[model samples]
Target: MRQEFDEEFEQFVRRWSPALLRVAFLLTSDRGEAEDLLQTALLKTSRHWSRLADRDAAYAYVRRILVTTHTSWRRRRRVHEVLLDQLPEHQAGQPREVEAGRALRALEELPPRMRAVVVLRCYEGLTEAETAEALGCSVGSVKSQASRGLARVRVLLDQSHADTAIPEGAR
Candidate 1:
């Protein structure tokens, strides 16, 4: 029975880790932090695996864990600056790449709960109810957060565009 439980848990991790990692990365704009966040969520999930009644709902269960854990971590951590060894090189890329970078930066500007709501609803394509469940909030809260978060992202993106735009006839 113990071996069976371990096997099932291992398989669950293997199958779901990539998707969960993407959620973690979206919540945390840093890859390293995303990995750590996912690891921590998975550790918690493992402890509760045997008690999960529905195996198929495990993904949603883990996602809820990820969201709550990230929220808690953000609340407890103090802001600190990391000094990089060298400046990052800017690459000249296609328009889509530029737009995506702007979008990600805009996402990083949002508050954590708002960001989580937007990511879960927009990026992950979860329904409002599902997003609310993952976020431990009411559906009405999810709706409001999604609305405000999207509006803020749009404003941020527009501001970035204005900052980078060339003057008329400057080309």
Candidate 2:
């Protein structure tokens, strides 16, 4: 039985690795950090595989690790960091990339939990209940985080609009 479960777990990890990496990328906005975060999450998940009651909950469990891991990483960086500009280059004729960059900046400004909630709910298209499960938080908290995250993003975008002179009707 244990061996069977192990095989199943391996298969699950293989199948979900791409999706998990994508989720991690959305959370961190850095490819290297995303890969590291996903690896750490998967390692932790593997350690607890046998104890996990519902196999289907593996994704949520791994995601929770990602959220917490990212939060810790960000917290540590806050204590010792200087300002730096590392924005990605936008392609010509790709207005969407510019908008995405603005949104990404807003996401980076959000608190870690709020960022995870927003990414899971909006980017990953997870339902509130699923997000709550993945975040290991109450649905109410997820709702609040989602609301606040979206509000903050909007504020950031609005500020960008005011700061830039891209014409009134361009966007």
Candidate 3:
């Protein structure tokens, strides 16, 4: 029975890790931190495996754990900034990459809970109720946060675009 439980959990991890990692990456905006976050979530989930009566709902359960854990970490200021001697050079001519970088930077500006709400609602395509459940918040809170977060992101992106735009007739 113990071996069966272990195998089941392992298979679930193998199947869902990629998707979960993507969520973590969006939440953290750093690949290394995302991996760490997902690992921690998985560990927590495994510990509660026996209590999970519905295997079909495991993904939702784990996702809720991920969001709560991330918000808690942010509250505790567990994330650290590493200073580098020099900035890395950006490759030119990749419009998508530039846009994605801008979007990520915009996300970084949001408060942790708001950022989680936006990522789960927009990027993950979760409905307001689903996002609220994941964040352990009321649906009304999710709605307000999503609205404000998206507006802030748009403002940030527009500012980024303006800063990078070439002057008219100056090319």
Candidate 4:
């Protein structure tokens, strides 16, 4: 039974990993973190592989796991933040990456649930109903979250551009 489950899990990973990784990347906004998120989701999913009703069910289940895991990780970090001596920072990306980077940073600033809702709806092209199902919430909640998330993202992007712009007198 374990061998059978392993084979099924491997096949599922091979088939769905690319799409899952793309979703994870949107959720994480970093290549390394995205890969790690997907791996963690897959690892969790594999434990219940034999019990999953079907491939689509497994995919949806794993997506939920990924979102919840990310939220948990964020909460853990917040809890330990004051105790930590320092956090490592990475070097800046290329000039061409600036706009994308700003958008991602803005997304990162959103609350975890809002970020997940935005990624599922906008990035994944899921309908409100579909998103509600994925997030295990009502359609109304999905609508509200998506609206607020998009609004926050717009404000963040505008602020980012404003910060980078030179004043007319200084130009």
Worst 10 residues of 3 by lDDT: 73-82
| Candidate 2, lDDT over the whole model | 0.86
User: When superposed on Cα atoms, how far off is each prediction in RMSD?
Assistant: 1.4, 3.4, 1.3, 3.7
Error of 4 at 37 (Å): 2.4
**Candidate 3 Cα outliers beyond 4 Å, as residue runs:** none
Off by over 4 Å in 2: 1-6, 79-90, 167-171
lDDT for residue 11 in candidate 3, whole number 0-100 = 96
- Per-residue alpha-carbon lDDT of candidate 2 for residues 30-136, written as tens digits (9 for 90 to 100): 88889999999988888888899998878777878888898888888775334768865657897788788788888888888899999999988999998998778
* lDDT digits (tens) for residues 47-144 of candidate 3: 99999999998998888888888888888885568799999898989999999999999999999999999999988899998888878789999999
Off by over 4 Å in 4: 1-3, 79-96, 169-171
Worst 10 residues of 2 by lDDT: 79-88
Tens-digit lDDT string for candidate 1 (39-111) = 9999998898999999999999989888899888888885836799999787776788889789989998898
Instruction: List TM-score per model, in order.
Output: 0.93, 0.80, 0.95, 0.82
The candidate that achieves the highest TM-score relative to the unseen native structure: 3
